[model samples]
Structure formats: structure tokens, C-alpha cells
Target: MSNVLYEVRDGIAIITLNRPEKLNALSIELGHELAAAWERFQSGPERAAILTAAGDRAFSVGADLTDPPEIWPFAPGVGVHVDKPVVAAVNGLCVGGAFILVQFCDLCVMSETATFVYPEAKIGLTGGLITSLAARMPHKLAMEFMMVGEPMTAQRAYEAGLVNQITAPDALMDAAMDYATKLAGLAPMVLSTIKRHVAEVLPKGPSEKAGIARRDLQAVRESDDFREGTTAFREKRPPQFKGK
Candidate 1:
């Protein structure tokens, strides 16, 4: 079965991450498929898009540790230019790279059980996700997530204005679709123009901010601490990070 699935109906493109057993973890193939799916949505007749995942366990548990994807270590929407609105239907445990998607979506509908987390600090790397989160959320809250690496519950996300709506797990898709349909009903050209204008007026989009992030993250990746962190994670032991 395909790791990513895409379909369009009633002017809304629906994209689903299909790896439920792994909590929809993004492997290399899945990341490429997801990027392609988004491109298809943008080029197709769809006026809006809904991004979701199969299964009740997770929207995505983030990147697959066993074999990470070569794509940007952030949300697909971050570096890509998609003029149409996109809504995220977060079901459960959304963490690491997955949290980037939640941050970039135009609207977000999260399941009551869903949680958002950024564990980059724990892994000894940082950049794009941090930059994007700071842009979308309040400074203090973004710092808490990036620095502490704690999970934020759906209620907290909603209260913080990070998500548009929160609902029972069973109602997540319905709520997301409702928002996407509303967006699709608007005048397409006007909607696209407004989206473009907003992006232009914003201080920076992910693509614009990514260059610095990539450089900084590359430096981190070369650090002995990064090696220690990954090695410890794989060996199931606490990382003994030394300031190196």
C-alpha cells in the first residue's frame, strides 16, 4: 500500500498518511509522496486541501528513526509554495517533524487526544521548526516547546491559538473538512490572492528562513553532542552530552 494517499472531491483535496502501524511515521518514501501529493493538490482543480492520517493512534509520530527521509526536516508546507488554504486534521500524537505541519497549516482541527511536541533540543539539533514555531506562536510559548521539548495537549494548543478547533477523536475529520469546504467555497482567485498577499507581508516564510536554519543545523549535526544523542537514543540509554 502507498504510504501517502491523495484524492479530491468537491474542490477539496484530501491527503492521508497511511502508515498506521508506525503511527504514520514519515520514511523517505512517505516524505517524497507527501510532497508530491501537495504539488498535485496545488496544480489540480482543488481549491483547498485537508491533511490527515489514517488510524486513531497518531496523525504522525514524526520522522521514522530507523531510516529518516532526505527531505527538509520540517513541514512540507514550510518550503513549498501553495497558494490555497490547507487544514490539518490532527488525530493523535503529533510530534517532532509532524508539529511543523500543524504550525504551517492555515487552519488546524485537533482531536482531543492529540498532542504536539518538538524534541529537537533533546536530539541536539534545531533550526527550521524553531523558526517556524516562533513565527506562528507567542515567543514565550515557542521557547518553552523548543527549549523544554514537552508535549502540548490539544486543549493547551487551542487555548494558545495554535489550533482553530478541537473535537473528539471521531469528530476530528468532520471538523477539518467543514473548514476546508468553507475555504473551497470562497472565490478561488480572491482566496489565492489574499493568501499570497499575507505570505508576502509576513516577515518570513519557511523557505525564506530555512537557509540560516540549515546552516546552523548542519553545524549541530557535526557536533559530538549530536552524535552522542543519536547514539544514546539508538542504544536506549541517556545521552551524556558534554559541551563540545
Candidate 2:
């Protein structure tokens, strides 16, 4: 089965990560598919997009260690900049690299069973690039999560304003869709312009704006270690990245 699935209904395009067996890990294939989907969503007839997953276990376990960055056209900001709108319907564990995906969405509706974390510290890697976007959380709380590598429950995330709403796992999609339907009805031009305008006003720190995300992403994107991670994954063995 494909790692990513795309469908459109009633002016809304829904992209589902299909690798339930692997907790919907963000593989290279899924990345490319997602990039393509974004491009289509931008130019296609859909007025909005809903990103979701197929299984109950994970909205996404995180980025697939096996896939190369360029394998898919999608990157942090490359594939598409729809401005049209994107919503995240987060169910189950939204950990590690998985959180990156949600961070890019316009709005998010998380399930009560969902949780968030940046476990890169556990793996001896820095999460600087992705963590830069975690500014939605309080400075102390964000620092605690990055430093301690502990998981935060969905309820805590909502209370902290990191997430919009929390409901049962089964109701997660409906809740997101309810919001999407509302967004779809607004004036498209007005909504898109507002999003872009607000993005321009947000204060980005010197370090954050100093190409930090680009530098960090480049390190992994071009590393021999990344290749090792993918090879080992394909062989069903743990990766012994050389940090090359």
C-alpha cells in the first residue's frame, strides 16, 4: 500500500498517511506524496486541505528515518504555500518528527489520546530546526520538553494553547472537519490575505531568522548518516549512523 493517500471531497482535499503498521512514519515516499498533494491542493479545485492518518495508533510516529529528504518534493516551505489553508486532525501519538507536520498547519484539532514531544535529545541529535516552530508553547514549557524529552498529553497541550480542542479519538476528524467547513465558507481571498499578512508581522528571533532551520535541515538532508538510517531501516535493523 502507498505510504500517503490523497482524496478530495466538497472542495476539501484530505491527505492521509497510510503506513499504519509503522505508526504512519513520515517516509520519503510519504513526503514526496505529500509535496505533490500540496501542489495539487494549491492549484486544484480544493479550497482547503485536511491532513490525517489511517490507523488509530498514531497520527504519525514521526519522520521515517529511512527516507531521504529530496525523495519527496515537500520540505518545510517548498512544495506548496497554499495560503488557502491547511488543518491538522491529530489522533494518537504526535511525537518526534510528527510534530513538525502539525506545526505547519493553520489550525489543529487534537484527540484526547494524542500527545506531543521532541525526543531528539534521546537520540543524541539536536531538534533546533523543528523546535524553532514550537514557539506556540510557553518558553519554559518548550524548554522543559526539549531538555527533558518528556511527553505532554493532549489535554495539557490544549490548556497551554498549543492545540485548539480535544475530543475522543473517534471524534477527532469530525471536529477538524467542522472547523474546515467553516473555513471553506469564508471569502477565500480575504482569508488567504489575512494569513499572509499575519505571518509577516510575527516576530522571529535573530537566531531563528538567522537561517538556523535551514542550516539544521541541511545537515541532515545531506549527511551520509541519513543514508545509513534509510539503509538500516530497509534491512529491518537498527541504524548505526556514523555522523558522516
Candidate 3:
């Protein structure tokens, strides 16, 4: 079965991550499919899109450890730039790389049971996601998440202005679709123009930002801490991080 699913109806493109058994963990295959789905939404008749994932356990637990890690085309707000607005229907656990996807959406509707986290520090990786979180939220709160690797509840996310709305699990998709449909009714050109304008005023171009992330990621990968972290993760033990 496909790792990702895409369908368009009523001018709303719905994209779903389909790896439920893995808690919707993102693999290289899924990433490619997701990028294609975004491209289709941008080039097709759809005025807006809704991003979701299959399963009640997770929106996405992050990257799939079974597959070699590589940059996905849909790195959100970085690699894939959608001219039309997008809404995130966060149903459950949103962690690590998954939170980056949420950061890219123009609006978010998360289930009350959902949680957000960035565990890059614990895994000894860093860069764009860390910087992006700081840009999207208060510096202190962003630091708390990035540095401490703690999970943030949906209500906390709402309070921090990271998500627009929170709903019961059953109502999550309905809320997201309702919002996307409303956005779809707006003038397409106007919406596109607004999105473009916002992008233009951002501190850096997407490519430049991505380049910085790549450089930082490379440095992290070469560090001893990275090897230790990965080893500990595989061994199911706490990592011993050293400044080296």
C-alpha cells in the first residue's frame, strides 16, 4: 500500500500519511509521495488543502528508523512552498520531524488528545527545526521544547499560539475540512498573492534556509554525540551526551 494518500474533492485537496502501523512514521517513500501531493494541490484546481494522517495513535511519530534518513522533499515551509493555504488536522502524537510539518501549515486544528514535541536534542540532531520553532513561538518556550525534548500538550500549544484550534478526536477532521472549505471560498488569486507576500517578507529564502540547515545537520552527524545517541536509542537506554 502507498505510504501516502491524496484525493481532491470540492476544491479541497486532502493529503493523508498512511503508515498507521508505524504511527505514520515518515520514510523516504512517504516523503516523496507527500511532496507530489503538495505539488498536485498547488497546480490543480484545489483552492486549499488539508493535511492529516491515518490512525488514532499518531499524526506522525517522526522519521522511520528502519529507513535511512534523508531530507524529504516536503520539509514544510522550507522545501515545499504551497501558494494556497493549508490546514493541519493533527489527530494524535506529533513529534520530532512531524512538528515541522505542522509548523508549515497556515492554520492548525489539533485533537485535544494530540501532543507536540521536538526530540532532536535527545537524538543529537539540530538546525532548521530548532530555528523554525523559535521563529514560530516565544524564544523561551521554543528553547524549552528544543533543548529539553519534552512533549507539549495540545492545550499548551493552543496557549502558545502554535495551533489555531483544538477539537475532540472525532471532530478533528470535520473542523479542519470546515476551515479549509471556508478558505477555498476566498478569491484564489488573492489568497495566492497573500501567501506569496508573506513568504517574501520572511527573514530568508527557503533555499537559503535549507542550506543553513544542511550545514548544521552535517556538523551534527559528524559529532561523536550523534553516534552515541543513535546507539543508545537502538539499545533502549539513555544517551550520554558530551559537548564533544
Candidate 4:
């Protein structure tokens, strides 16, 4: 099944984390599709995007246990440079790495049922990308949220300025769409400029920088020239580089 679904309404793109059967876990397949969806949003005519999940029970429960994914796909300002405004409509559990997804968004309207969790510290595992949280919210609160590994309720998330607003589960998408619609009506160039500059102002964590570097390195690795060079070496012949 396709793990991500992209739709557009009135110039606003709606990207769904569609793995309800698995609670929209960030599996490898889902990660690739989500990355493609972000690329589409960057190049498509859509003026803004609303990121939400398929189920009301959870936006995402973090990485898939048996099949985790690289951090690039989930990254917006980091690996994926998306200038358009993005809003997160989070429902229930947004755990661990999943919380970073919400963090990268421009604004968020979370459901009252939603709770944020970062259990990496307790699990003897950690993804340093979560450090971006400090740049998003109060440093002390971000540190406590990551180090303590407790479930942050919707109200606390709002009070800490982690989330912009909180609404009923049924009203989550409506609130996100409202934000998207408003953004779509604004000047696109101005919005993109401001978004890009804001990202520059924010301090990027180590893993976040690595994610960006990975994107560049991955392109070269996947390029046709890379294949040609390898094949030529095997044949003991001069390689014809296309500069791809």
C-alpha cells in the first residue's frame, strides 16, 4: 500500500502520513514516499501544504522497529529544503523521531488527544536531530522533553510554544486547512523568502547538517556517472563522465 497520499485543494497541498494500520510508523517505504511528496510540494503549483496523518489515534509512533528509515525524508529545513509554508495537523501520539517532523513545520494545530513523546533516552537510543527542538522552543523545556522522555500533553505543548494551537480530533484537519488557505492567499515569493531566511537564522544540529550533506552525497551516488565510472573501472577502460 502507498504509505503517503498527496492531494491538492484550492492551491493548498494536503500530504497524509497514510499508514493507519501501522499507526503511520516511519517505515522505509513511508519515508521514501514522504520524501517524494515533499519534492512535489516544492515544485508543484500548490502554494502551501498541510501535513496530517490517516488515523486519529496517532500521527506517527516514530521509526518502524524492524525497518527504520534515513532522517532525510522527515526533514524539511534540514535535508529537504521546502520554502513554502507547512502546517502539521497532529492527532494522537507523536513519538520520538516523529516529533521532529512536527518541529520542522512552520506552524502546527494539534488535536487535544495528541501527546508528544521522546523515549529515545530511556530506550538507550537517540537521534541527535531532536536537538533542533531547542531552536524551536524554550531551551530548558526542550531539554527536559528530550532528556526526561515523558509524554507531553497537547495543552503543555501549546503553552511551551511547541504547537501553535490545539483543537478537537474532528477539528484538527479543519484548523490546518484554514492555515493553509490563509497562506495560499498570501504572496508566494514573500513567503518563501521569509521562510528561507528564518531557516538560516535557526541553528542546525549535527544530525541535521549530516542529513543535508547526505542529500548531496546521495545524489552523486545515484547519478548515472557513478555507475559508468564503476562499470568502466571493471572493464579497465576510460570512463565517459556525463557530469550528471
Clashing pairs in 1: none
lDDT of 2 at 135: 59
TM-scores, all models, native as reference: 0.81, 0.79, 0.82, 0.91
Candidate 4 vs. true structure, TM-score: 0.91
Clashes of each: 0, 1, 0, 0
Residues 108-188 of candidate 3 have per-residue lDDT tens digits of: 999999999888888876545446567677889978988898999999999998999999999998999999999999998
State the displacement of the C-alpha of residue 1, model 3, in Å, after optimal TM-score superposition. 0.8
lDDT of 4 by residue, 1-244 (tens): 6899999898899999999999999998888888889989998999999988998789999999889887655577666779999999999999987888988999999999899999989888776899988998899999999999999999999999988889988988889999999999999999999998998899988888888888888879999999999999999999999999
Candidate 4 clash figure, as a count? 0
Q: Please, what are the lDDT tens digits per residue for candidate 1 over residues 78-120?
A: 5455788999999989978777766777889999999998897
lDDT of 2 at 19: 87
Which of the two, 2 or 3, has more lDDT? 3
Model with the higher lDDT, candidate 3 or 4: 4
Which is the leading candidate under TM-score? 4
Better of 1 and 3 by TM-score: 3
| Backbone collision tally, model 2 | 1
Clashes counted in candidate 3 amount to 0
